[model samples]
Target: MPHIHVRHYPRNFTEEQLRAIDEAVTAAVTSTFATGEDTVSISLEPVTPEDWDSQVLAEIAARRDELIKAPGYWNES
Candidate 1:
């Protein structure tokens, strides 16, 4: 089974947007993986508006010292 995870912000997305995303995922799997839409599993997660930006900021802050001190930490292949 092929699993696809789609994450979206909570505030601005509409039903049409969600439908489009689902369609796109189905199309992508069918085209690229040669899989039927029924076999493609999708999970959609929406983050709360208040928690989203704060979570991102916290992650950046936690990594800030390493980011500033060692460019290799971020640029490693």
Candidate 2:
């Protein structure tokens, strides 16, 4: 059960865009894990710049070791 959660800056993503994102993630997850497509779930979170540090960065710091991919543009300011 691989649940993919993507956090990004706020943007108005349309249904088509969302579907495209979900499909791409599903393909990757299924191919990598050799699992059924139905088992893969995807969610997108829009994090504003003002709240990124407190909300997203805190979680990233707490789960640093568990992150498969880490953000490269991290700034303390």
Candidate 3:
């Protein structure tokens, strides 16, 4: 399973806020999947917005049409 990783910019969130978010995520995932809390782990890594954008771009390039359909990929043109 892919790890749940969160990247936040500097000075964006407090430690308590981050912990709350992490716990909320853990609860949501564990509730839906019927898994142990240990199985649903979260990692908080701080990074700039540009880096996060780049990661999204790279992910799109890698998955492209297989995971994301273009305007008319499914329908006959």
Q: Of models 1 and 3, which has the larger lDDT?
A: 1
lDDT of each: 0.70, 0.89, 0.67
TM-score for every candidate vs. truth?
0.54, 0.86, 0.58
> Which residue pairs overlap in candidate 1's backbone?
none
- Taking the candidates one at a time, how many backbone clashes does each contain? 0, 0, 0
Worst 10 residues of 3 by lDDT: 68-77
Arrange candidates by TM-score, descending. Answer: 2, 3, 1
| Deviation from native of the Cα of residue 35 in model 3, angstroms | 0.6
TM-score of 2: 0.86
lDDT of 1 by residue, 1-77 (tens): 68986544765668898789889888988899897888988887776767854664456556776543433334333
Q: Stretches of candidate 3 above 4 Å error?
A: 64-77
Model 2, 1-77: lDDT tens digits are: 99988889999999999899988899999999999999999888999999998999999888888988778876534
Residue pair clashes in candidate 3: none
